[model samples]
Target chain A: MGLNTRIEAAISNAVKVGQAKFPDNSGAVPPRLASALAYATAPGGARIRPTILTSVAMACGDDKPMLADAAASALELIHCASLVHDDLPCFDDADTRRGKPTVHLAYSEPLAVLTGDSLIVLAFEILARQSSHAPDRVAQMIVTLAQRTGMPGGICAGQGWESEAQIDLSAYHQAKTGALFIAATQMGAIAAGQEAEPWFELGARIGEAFQVADDLRDALYDADTLGKPAGQDDLHGRPNAVTLLGVQGAIQRLKDILGGAISSIPSCPGEAQLAEMVRMYAERLTPVVSPQSVPGE
Target chain B: MGLNTRIEAAISNAVKVGQAKFPDNSGAVPPRLASALAYATAPGGARIRPTILTSVAMACGDDKPMLADAAASALELIHCASLVHDDLPCFDDADTRRGKPTVHLAYSEPLAVLTGDSLIVLAFEILARQSSHAPDRVAQMIVTLAQRTGMPGGICAGQGWESEAQIDLSAYHQAKTGALFIAATQMGAIAAGQEAEPWFELGARIGEAFQVADDLRDALYDADTLGKPAGQDDLHGRPNAVTLLGVQGAIQRLKDILGGAISSIPSCPGEAQLAEMVRMYAERLTPVVSPQSVPGE
Candidate 1:
């Protein structure tokens, strides 16, 4: 099956697991909590992180397909949870995400908070359950996910940076965006019984590229095109590549990062295919104008 | 070292780990976030859950004290994080916990949320890192913690029940208080290389007993004695044994459950010692005024 199809199926299955496990024998789950979880994850955007993970696993010759799928699903769930929390009123206060109302907007703020917490737990739960066949891999993946998601240097720290009086752009961006990407690459390699250390550079570069792309999109696009609120970084007084480096320089930086990302793919049997995947992502990251959207046509 | 001392030491060490890992090269960790994580856990009350966990591990013949400590610390961290979130404005809106300002009041609402989140992730990270000697055990503990902390039947579900229009007292008590107790027992057993199944009933009984005791305290004790707000269940219009069964009946129920808990310890080499420990807990749960505070004195 195609990678995207596999990811879609995996995600759907994971959400089903979440749904089935959410309700009790009487079929009672806080409807809002259940729905928020599904809404945050369903009809996912791009699936870039999971796709990168799967590509890494495939390049490393994935022998444990189930584990690979679980890793992908788990990473995506974490991403979804982050988005849910990020859109909270205290955070970005975003009303929409992925072209739909954010979890906090669709549900109450408290449920949104609980949903985010539950999703993070669910992500680790999925990984732990899937790694039963490979105990060591599961343990490593748990550590990787937790470290990237929590503190010391995780997404939590990334968010916490916003509360600080000062911010370090590199550290902020790395934890905010790069941590999960690192987890994806590392978890993919671990799932495939490959050394994870070698893939960090590739994941970091890709993450940097993605962040730069996000900055450009936020600065250049409107909410209609982005499917979410744009100009968020500037509004929040948060750090961003575009604001720091200017639009053209940010776009140039993104290209350079993507180039580095492609070159950084660790030596593996499927190196060429992985490089191609990176190239495809690079193309998508570049802004394109459709003919029908031309104002003077 | 004595068990209490060991638990105190372990908790302190875990906080140190949290503090040490929170900062970057700049030695900055959003000071409030770091302090919140530390403060929420310090001067802990009772340490009952960790005590039970360690007791179970010892009864099961734990050889890896480090892993046992890690497991115990992990469960405690989850409990602490839950307390932090539970006291948030949208939830209980508690102003104090354990006789001090709660995380939200002491820090800020957003920081409290992030602190709770970072601690949960930190729990799993501690377990994963310390369980290097037993990968299988670590995997089991991770799954166990996630299950108890997250959805369907976890603490999150328990909290979710509060948001529902209807409430199930049994399910509510089980998840809100019982879940962590069950995790403590099961994780202890897993850490000791024993089957966790035998310990579930014991944990559940203990959990139910603890909940009943809490209900009794909430219904009867003053804020000064309880070190927090009293009659919270009534104040929040939540389900509780005291309200359902009356204070006397709740006390009676607490006694009955304590008896059941004593009789429920799974057979092991240290069965007698474990029984003694349960009995000690039972005595404590029965409640008594200090000798200096006798009414007729």
Candidate 2:
């Protein structure tokens, strides 16, 4: 199947798994919290991370849908948790997400906070419960995820850094965005029972490339196309690669990073497919117009 | 050493472990986030749950402090995460906790939310890192922790239930307050290589008794003594055993439940000190005043 078709299927599967895991009225939660959780997890997004995870797993010759399901759900949970916290009044103070009111805006702030907390817990729970992977592999995956989600080098630290330090743009983006992307790739390989160390460098490079693309999008894309507010990073004085390097410089850097990511894929059995997928993603990010392009046009 | 001293020492050890595990300014995290996390996890609370866990583990004949550390930290993290969420404007809307400004009140709400999320993830991370335990046991512990933290039977579900449904007071207390208590007992036993099922009933009964004591304290104790807002639960109109059974009936029920909890301890080797500890706790809760004593007077 084409990469887009595979991505669509993966997104649908992720939604299905999330729905199956979190029903509308899971006995202990009040209807409102459950509804909010379901709402937050349901609407399909780009599913880029899950697609990368599944594709890597597939490229490693492991086609178990269950691994994809677990990894996808875990990634989504992390993403959702980040979004919930980011939209709180203290952070971005966003009112909407994916065209709907954000968790804190839709639910009460307390529920929103708890919802994020629960989702983070649930991500580990999903990884822990995946019977297909070895217990040790699962444990390692959980640790990697937790490390990426916690105080140092995790999304939390990424957000917290904005308030105090004059952070390096690369480090900021790597922690806030690239860490999870790297994790998604590594976890997929781990689930496939492959020696993931060989792929770790490639994953990190790809993740950085993806972050640069995201930076470019934030600097240039419209909110309507991105499905959320754009250019807010520059407005909030948060460090970004685009800000450090002008638009053209950032785009060139993205290309160089993408090349490095693609080139780093080892000559494994299914490396060709993985390389192609990486190339496609790079091309897709190349043509997206920046918001600066039409200023006052 | 006396059981109390032993338990206290165990808790101190667990605190050291937790502190050492979550270091300040780990290169992985941005400096600000690291400082915030260190601040959030700084040692100050009573550490009652960890003490209970270590005491139970020792009582069950597992004297290894390291084994208990993971479980202890996990429990505390869950507790800390809950407290952070509880204090947000959407829930109790409290400004203080443990005689200090709540996390949200101290940091921005988003930071508080992310801090809480990090704690939840960290809890699982600790469990996953305990290489000393059998993989199955560790996985089981993670599952139990997740179930108690997630929807349906966790504190999150308990809090969510408050928004809708006139939930039964017993069920509400069991999910919200009792689940962790049960986890503490079960984890302690598991750490000792003992079966956890036998202790589940006992721990749950003890948790219920403790909740009853909490109700009494909330109704009768002043804010200065309780270290939290007095009678806030009643003000919120949430169901409580005290509200349902009345002061006299609740006290009687508390006594009965305490007795049951003490009796439920198995007649096994190495249980004498644990039994004595249970007896002391039950005796401590015996009613001092008649029903004529006004609540919150």
TM values, all candidates: 0.93, 0.89
DockQ values per model? 0.52, 0.49
Task: Give the per-residue lDDT digits (tens) of candidate 1, residues A245-295.
Answer: 867677789899999988888899999999999999899997664544322
lDDT per residue (tens digit) for residues A1-297 in model 2: 765565455444433332243321233336677677677775756667777877788888765656656766787678877888788777788877888788877887767876776677777777777743577777777777777677556677667667664775555666677777777788778777776667677767887887778877887777877777888888898767877787788889999999898888876678998899889889987755646583342
Which lDDT tens digits does candidate 1 get at residues B34-97? 7788899988999899999999999999878887899898888989999998898888889889
Best DockQ goes to which candidate? 1
**A156 Cα displacement, candidate 1 (Å):** 0.3
Q: Candidate 2, residue A17: CA error in Å?
A: 8.6
Q: Evaluate model 2 with DockQ and give the value.
A: 0.49
- Candidate 1 regions with alpha-carbon error over 4 angstroms: A21-31, A289-297, B21-28, B288-297
- Give lDDT: candidate 2, residue A12: 48
